[model samples]
Target: MVTGKAIVLSVLVTLSVVVRTASQLPIPPRYDGFVYKNRISADSVLVEAFFDPLCPDSRDSWWPLKEALRYYKHNITFIVHPFALPYHNNAFIASRSLHVANKINTSYTFPLLERFFRYQQNFYNKPTLQTSPATITQQIIHFALEKTGNSSFEKFVLGFQDKSSDMTTRISFKYGCSRAVTGTPYFFVNGIPLNIEETLDFAKWKSIIDPLLAEQAQAYT
Candidate 1:
């Protein structure tokens, strides 16, 4: 459930092109799990990551985050939400494509995400400044279809052009707004926002997540 005030603030976020902090926004009313549940008792941690498909910072975070996930395995439940920043041109297309991928094949979503991050440079403001939206759409369609492998091209295009894609992408943005995620790569560990000012590595992430797992293990006994 989104409040009127938060809705208004999220609108204001798009009026500017620069990425800004949204500390003033109220904490969202709810945060149900997007992926796996907690590791232990009520006091346990749930890792939730909000990302923009075309944001570089979000791309940088994925490496360390993936490494940490590999190390922790089933000991953690990490949820990923795509929060496409408005300032980045065609970001909505990429984000919407994610939902389309999920509809076609949930398993393809991760591979599609990796492809988006790797090729983000191609879709940036400057590179695509002269490019038309139709052309970009085709590029995205091709990229996504290739990732989906045997997925029908017709279905891919149909899903991409569906109104539901836009709605789902907007829902993702609004969800991020509810969480006061004003910028890209917003992360919350156990509902507490992580400081991402510095580059994060597996060690840095482990320093935080390892303890939570340890505490959960201690309590499980």
Candidate 2:
């Protein structure tokens, strides 16, 4: 009994409703990392960093990043993603060690990363000794025990190495590749790529981040 016009109107209304529902749904968060400042806020800006612990450039980048973390501690959440480049001989093993350190205790993540960066040359320059996967794994296990003073952490690292370490490393590497990351020390602020030059300059970083933080503050006011 319905007229053609009424049928068309009903279809249009249904389609509009579907579109509105889809638009209102929240987008899923991308980029998982070792999260610092784990609070959820509408105004909070996320800073995601992709780095290899052994890369000199990544090590250099950490100083400025530390300064930024101090300056923006209240307004931002920082996430560290390990992207192990193939060229770095021990990168994969080093990244897996970081994952192991994070699993045993999140507190150890930065320290372990710092240790690896600090001793990277020593790890690289093995003249008489051959650095196989098992050798590196043992070295990390020993390093973790020495640093953490927790003997139980050894079992966790060994288990991770045997089962999930490679998978976890690959997943992080693939995620970085998907995002078009081709080098170490890449950063994303609020899902946008942050310039390397800006990363080192506090004034430049503040210029980009302050405006976003201001917008968030205005919304509350």
After superposition on all C-alphas, the RMSD of every candidate to the true structure, in Å, is 8.8, 8.4
In candidate 1, what are the lDDT values of residues 1-221, reduced to their tens digit?
99999998888877553444543333333342235322333454678888777999999998988888878777667888888888999898888888887777667787888899998998999989999988898888888877887455787789877987777777778878877889978889988998778768899989999888888889879
TM-score of each: 0.79, 0.77
Error of 2 at 190 (Å): 0.3
Candidate 2, residue 137: how far the Cα is off, in Å: 1.7
Off by over 4 Å in 1: 1-44
- Candidate 1 whole-model C-alpha lDDT, 0 to 1: 0.79
- The per-residue C-alpha lDDT of model 2 at residue 169 equals 70
Clash pairs (backbone) in predicted model 2: none
lDDT of 1 at 108: 76
> Which parts of model 2 are misplaced by more than 4 Å?
1-31, 37-40, 125-129, 197-199
| lDDT by residue (tens digit), candidate 2, 114-206 | 887787775664541476777776776777576777775656567565656566777778778878899988989989987555336666668
What are the lDDT figures for the candidates, one per model?
0.79, 0.76
lDDT for 34 in candidate 2 is 78
